[model samples]
Target: MRFKIIFPTGYQVADILNDNIDINVVLENGDVFFGTLFTISNLDYLLAISQEPFFYASDLLIVKDLSKKNIRAAIESLVSGSIELAFTKIRSTWSNESGSDSFDTIIDMC
Candidate 1:
């Protein structure tokens, strides 16, 4: 799945671009997507009436809703910058181990 969020102002866009902030997408399901994906300047000029900067996360895993605790854990792991570690733990239990091997795989997925 591909998800995108628009920054209403230039300040927000500049901060995201300059700081190279990692985007963490916690779906309603347990699956989490984390990546640095905001370099394009004119990705959606026509779609955005204001032409604000848009961040798009692609190739995310699709799953059902997760428990509240699991959602919190996913958020914590992504924010802590231990995505690989988190995925390593999750992959052991996750049926689709093929998708959650390394950070490079995560990047490629995103």
Candidate 2:
């Protein structure tokens, strides 16, 4: 599966994140992170640790299309100590599709 992330208004992902194309991946197990997509058939060989953000890809599943206000609210919610709740509020902003994960492409609007 493929996924797209619609970032919040006035929000900008840092330039450092731009070169990390290997990070935009979604696992079949429902883990989500930004970078470039990658599919792994084996989880046993996977080991990752980071102080950056992390969340379940499934949390990105939307209930409806999102608005800018929704995106802003979700961003604000991030500091409330519940990542799941923040993601839940912004779920509408994320979308997924069926596709192969063999390419590296990123669109940086900033």
lDDT against the true structure, each candidate: 0.34, 0.30
- Residue range 1-103, candidate 2, lDDT tens digits: 3333333333432332121112222222344443221122111112234344543344332211133343334333442444444233322222344343322
Give per-model TM-scores. 0.23, 0.23
Stretches off by above 4 angstroms in model 2 are 1-65, 84-110
Error of 2 at 91 (Å): 21
Question: Model 1 — which ten-residue stretch has the worst lDDT?
Answer: 2-11
Q: How large is the C-alpha RMSD of every model relative to the true structure?
A: 13.7, 16.5
Q: How high a TM-score does candidate 1 get?
A: 0.23
Positional deviation of 103 in candidate 2, in angstroms? 29
Can you write out model 1's per-residue Cα lDDT over 17-101, one digit (the tens) per residue? 2232234443323445444333233334323655556544442221122323333443454545645543222212211247553
